[model samples]
Target: MQVMDPLTSPKIGGNHLFCYALLFILIASHVSLSASARELKVEPKGSVKDLVQSSKATKIKRTVNGLLEVVLVDAKGLKDTERFSGGMDPYVMIKYKTQERNSPVAKGAGSKPVWNKRFSFRVQYPDYAGGNGYKLILKLMDKDSFTADDFIGETVIYVEDLLVLGAEKGKYQMLPTKYRVVGSNKKYNGEIRVGLSFTPIR
Candidate 1:
């Protein structure tokens, strides 16, 4: 058996060194190219500002005109006020943006009243929704002949959530299922069913 010493095998050593040198060149070239590619992608802070301005411009195009339709489906578990003897007369008040709509006084339905009424409000962007979101407010009240209507329960819903879910104008986007009513100190009293949708202005 003959063992060939690596030091004595110049041809073999040369081949091995050549292979390693080729591998090193390939690796170095790859790294250099990658670094140059990265350097070509220079994203400046002004690019960020440009992107923000582009976003604002697109939003302005969407700000043509829209109508937010809030439908007061029904409400349950309302506070039965001792301020009255019989079943309390209940109605729902809806406030969205700077617009408000009061449902017809459901004469004497008391707790668990049903309105199934729909209200619409005009929205010109940057006015109703210039910032983050527009909030939908629903308040249950008791109508009285002599005194002002009594507040039963209230809940607030944000249109931003639905809008972010890819709600386009002229399309109806129903709100979640129902909202629990919370009072002055965030007291839970009842749950109300409502639907929300946006439509392009005519």
Candidate 2:
């Protein structure tokens, strides 16, 4: 067995020590950078389509006894600012209390949008909100790209007038009644054409 001298055997010179220190620093820096990278996260923003789908999910819990049926015939004379490439796309959001329904997109309809879409909202008489002078609010909106839908105009029909007008005519069809769509600064933007047929369910 041969033994080497402690003092003369491969002494760590200043150059080797400096190289070791540099290697240690490099390794530590790489580890630190890796840890920092692992902690970072990026969240994504929700799209407009997502919002539309979510809105569809929120529905009303209908009551059984003495329900009222409101029919949505069609809409006309809606003026919307052009947003999309070709033309404006519009849709209707029909809301009453906890009940809500969305009309199909009026593709390339521009100002004159017609959705002959029908939606039924159930309400118990006496306990019903429509009988209490609450009007049916229709918000004509333009669907945009990144943001929420833009409001084109709005029209509200008195619920009391709906049933009474039908009783007076002796039929459900309340004629082609034109509700003036009011806009910003109380200006008349356009008229929305809608019909009401009240059916009292047993």
Candidate 3:
């Protein structure tokens, strides 16, 4: 058996320690980047092409009903200049406007949707003006006990009558809508997609 002296053993050098630290940082950075890439869950179910807007009516031809989930991300990787003094229980608010006979019956019928911990909402289309056409504006709210902040991202949904469509070919068609967002937080970025199930009226 070979014996080695404890005091004479080669002491670890600072350079060696530094090299170890560098390696550790590199590995840690790689791991962190990989984790972030997988952290955000964003998915698009079905094709947006399936959504078409009607020319005759100001509403989309298809009936939409189901779950909607969104993720908040850093669009520009900007930092928050102002601290958000808002509560953590964020919610989704759906505001609708129904138009029939070139008249607006419902201006803003708002609903506070049931939200999951991840800030997701399951929204239902309401019956408006005898099942006629309706236009919707959806917004998010950061809620406390009695206060709310309007979310950065806002979208519009045009809900049409179920029984009859306004397509030229007398066939069903989809609609087009847009969403826009602006915020003070440089890091605050968001994207959303909805999972829906459609039922035709008999």
Better of 2 and 3 by TM-score: 2
User: 72-111 in candidate 1: lDDT tens per residue?
Assistant: 8888888787443788888888887667799988788888
lDDT of 2: 0.64
lDDT of 3 by residue, 62-130 (tens): 554433322222122112222454223334455433321111111122221222222233334444443
Clash pairs, model 2 backbone:
none
Candidate 2 local lDDT, 1-202, one digit each (tens): 8786443558767687677779989999999999999999976775534433443344223432333354555556666677446567888787766677788888878877777766777654224553434467788788888877777887777664344332333334455577888876578888877766655554
If both were scored by lDDT, which would come out higher, candidate 1 or candidate 2?
1
What's the C-alpha lDDT at position 47 in model 1?
A: 49
Structure candidate 3, residue pairs in collision = 51-174, 51-175, 52-174, 52-175, 53-174, 53-175, 78-187
lDDT of each: 0.72, 0.64, 0.38
Q: Point out where model 1 deviates above 4 Å.
A: 1-62, 126-133, 163-170
Q: In candidate 2, which residue ranges exceed 4 Å CA deviation?
A: 1-67, 83-86, 128-132, 164-171
Model 1, position 116, has a per-residue lDDT of: 81
Best by lDDT: 1
Judge candidate 1 at residue 102 and give its lDDT: 92
